[model samples]
Target: MVDELEKAKPIIIKRVKRKGHDFHGGSWKVAFADFATAMMAFFLLLWLMGNTSEDEKQAISGYFHDPSGFQEKAGSSPAVIGEGGANVAVIEIETIQPETDDIESEISKNEASNKPLSEEELAKLAEQKEIEKLKQLKKELEFLVENSIDFSQFREQVMIDITPSGLRIQIVDKDKRPMFDSGSAEPKYYSKTILRGLANVLKQVPNKLSVTGHTDATPYVERENYGNWELSADRANAARRELLFGGIKEKKIARVEGFSSSILFDQQNPHNPVNRRIAIIVLKRSVAENIEKQVLGVE
Candidate 1:
């Protein structure tokens, strides 16, 4: 029976079965994607080269070479074009020089029309400059006294202003806090600190200085020829010596005058404590010249 079954199956089971090929491998898709990417990169490069301005191109080139944008030495360098692979080219471009004929002609015309200032005009200009400088000095002194820790406490006592002569810095006396001992030219401890600071600032300026001393109108008995005038004069000279010791040049001192109660700080109250003060005047060069001329009777 087994032999008969085998023979029958062998004769009948001759059917054909067809199978489709595996998905044509996906490798072809990968190759197509790579081709598209390369084409996109090529087009982008073309757009950049065509549209970029000269300065933009130069800046990009500089960034590539030095990402940190720091130079070893400060100097001018020649501009560069794209310097790589396909666009590598050493272009030596010359800068366009601006025409200066019009400028030169304008300058020449101005020179021809200009006239030298007369003596009076020159003097007026000098006075204007001096006034401006004095104003600046006054502002600086005010700032120093107002801001400094050591000097700020004396802000009320220190007065800085621009005068007709030049800048005037005054350290006036308060009833309770006198800069000097009563009827004495000796400076208090705080007064020395202020003077030293002032000397340091005064040394920076080229202007000559004048120190004046004033006294209150209270009467004092003359003893051994020592009176208000001598006391005021001695005090002014004493302040001058302190300034010199604190580094102020002796040559910068133009004058030291003592007006014993003659110039009252408060005209209404002759015996006001504010009248007893030390006055430091920064004299402008022009003002000093005027004073000199007056002294010599040359004006």
Candidate 2:
């Protein structure tokens, strides 16, 4: 009975020893390896954060949180490189700032330098200059007509308006003194004197000038052969000829338009005496340039 008991005890001890050898716990080694790997990752993150911009760092932080639009690319390790020349890990920099600030600086400079004048400001300046020039011309015309006719009446008939295009000097016709002899294209003696004075003033200015003739809607009874169009055109041409005679260069005359009653002062009252008139249009250089381009076939 003692010998059987001893044999069973030895067998049980041998089994226990075998079991201990087979199931040797490795939890300490696994914990040590995990600690080492975490330390390496921590250092790598620190190094990458040092190299990346603020925007890029924020992007990477966002990617880790959601990874919705993040894509992994094959590249160099943001950490230490392996001796075998294979990249084991990578750090992505998503938002890189532009390096050249010159473009931004140049845009700022251009904005500062090339500011344009407002429409109101431009209009005010043009009107002021035009008014000054017209006042000077008015004085000269008053002096010229002092001998023959009452200059005060002429002043009331003539008016100068500054427009976006340029200065427009209008000679309005009335019952007392019509600019043209009733339906005829011929200028009255006083009207010729006034036109010569206008030409003399125009010759001093450097702007391009245009002569236009306008007539009231009253039909001609005596000169039925020459309609309003022909009379208007002839009157404009006569004024142009007088301007040339008064020392104005023939080339400076831009155009002569005969607007027979189409552009009346008062369309409802077509027989208004003011509708029968002559207009001297002074064009600015900018306006002349646009006209010149059209004439030369330039786009």
Candidate 3:
């Protein structure tokens, strides 16, 4: 009975099925590959642009601007020159040219006309050029004075201005900062430094130069036969020598003069310190020409 009961006992078996994670799509991989390919093409395009010649670049630009214009004007012809077949033979090709060349040619034609300019017109042209050069020189000097620490300290004393005569550069004296020794023509060290620096700049312009010296109304009787007039003249000459030392040609100097308290900068105060100064003028072309003609005894 026991054996029959054991054999009749029920037996059970269970099985669990576990599902895997969801499958992610491959869209991002395709997008990333496309981005990488685009970057590579972009770099290749940049390299090509960097290596292309100006003419090739222009040709490419023209083709893009008007693709139809790049087509060759042609007619149907035989491929072997005897039998007629559907064939296009390019006879001519038109190219795009820059518009600036046309404008330049027009200007050149106008300027290179047969008729010569009158003397007055020539003078006006020369004057215009002289004015331009002087203005540029003035600008350079002003920039130097403003930006350079060496020149900034004496900015007030180093006065520069444009006048009808031409560019006028004045190195004037302060109350205690005289450019020269009192009652003497000897230039102070800093004064020589200033003159040499100015000379290097003045050498760039083709115009003739005029250097002048002036003194205040205070009378000087320190040396025999040496008054303000002689002192001023000597000072002017000394400045000229320094200019020559700084690489300016001697022929560039048109005149050296001295005015003893005659043209006081501050008219109200005759003895003002500012009256003592060195004035260097870059003469205009017309004036220089007139000077040359006069020296040559031409009417």
Candidate 4:
């Protein structure tokens, strides 16, 4: 029995060294490498936080406070808030100041107060004023005619009519009181009296006046020396001078036109006596109004 036991113990006498590759396992080394990478990332985040500005910090905080906080993970910048969170800029809100009720009220009042007069109203007022002026002028002229000694001598030539243009006072041919010389540009004696009366009446009214001269169609044999055109122009100028002398302002006279058988009373009857005369016209105020508007650049 002792010899059999010695034989069983002698069966496992050879012991060999284990291989180095078989003893090593990589699980602990991989876990240590992962832990080192995590520590490096954590330190980088701390360095970035230390360098951040106040505005950047506030912006980051605002991003976190947003309702969809996780949406900023898509690399979008957050809504910016100013320093100390006191001055925050909202992108959706406009910065303009609202107009007050007082300002609107003042604008409305000015618009209403500066409204312009209508065309019809202006025309009616102008016509009424012109008619009133004409009536007053007629009364004064009648009074002067009544007081004058040679009123009847002036009667045959003197005439008054209210045309569409306003007033037309004609002084036609008379024997001793010819408005102009028979064959010259010179005016006669009694013509001055008629002009003085017309000027006196014109000065009282504010309406503008135009003095026009007309001549007979008879072509003079001495037309080469003194033509009808020259005679007509001279007569109109003479009338203007007489009017100025009798107290009518030169500014009140708009213009003086001379027509040599051009604008006759009877176009068919060229030799009519009534066609040769001087006319005094009281122009409508609309002419002055239009000129004023043109100068001021108003519509």
Model 3 C-alpha lDDT versus the unseen true structure:
0.72
The best-first sequence of candidates by TM-score reads 1, 3, 4, 2
The list of candidate 1 runs beyond 4 A from truth reads 1-112, 294-299
Candidate 2 ranges beyond 4 A from true positions: 1-150, 221-225
**Between which residue pairs do clashes occur in model 3?**
none
- Which scores greater on TM-score, model 2 or model 3? 3
State residue 20's C-alpha deviation in candidate 3, in Å.
67
TM values, all candidates: 0.61, 0.51, 0.61, 0.53
For the record, the alpha-carbon RMSD of candidate 4 to the native fold, in angstroms, is: 35.6
RMSD of each: 21.2, 31.3, 20.4, 35.6
Flag the better candidate by lDDT, 2 or 4: 2
lDDT, candidate 2, 1-299, per-residue tens: 99888878844344444345533678877888999999999999899988975434444555555443333322232321222222212222211112224334544565688855466755555545554554454444443343223243586678776666666788889878898888777888778867876675577666788899988898765665778888888899988888888778988888888988878977889999999999887776556667779789997
Give lDDT for model 1.
0.72
- The runs of at least 3 residues in candidate 4 whose Cα sits more than 4 Å from the true structure, single-residue gaps closed, are 1-117, 175-177, 223-226, 266-269, 288-299
lDDT of 1 by residue, 215-288 (tens): 88986564777778887888898889889977899998988988888889998999899999899998877777
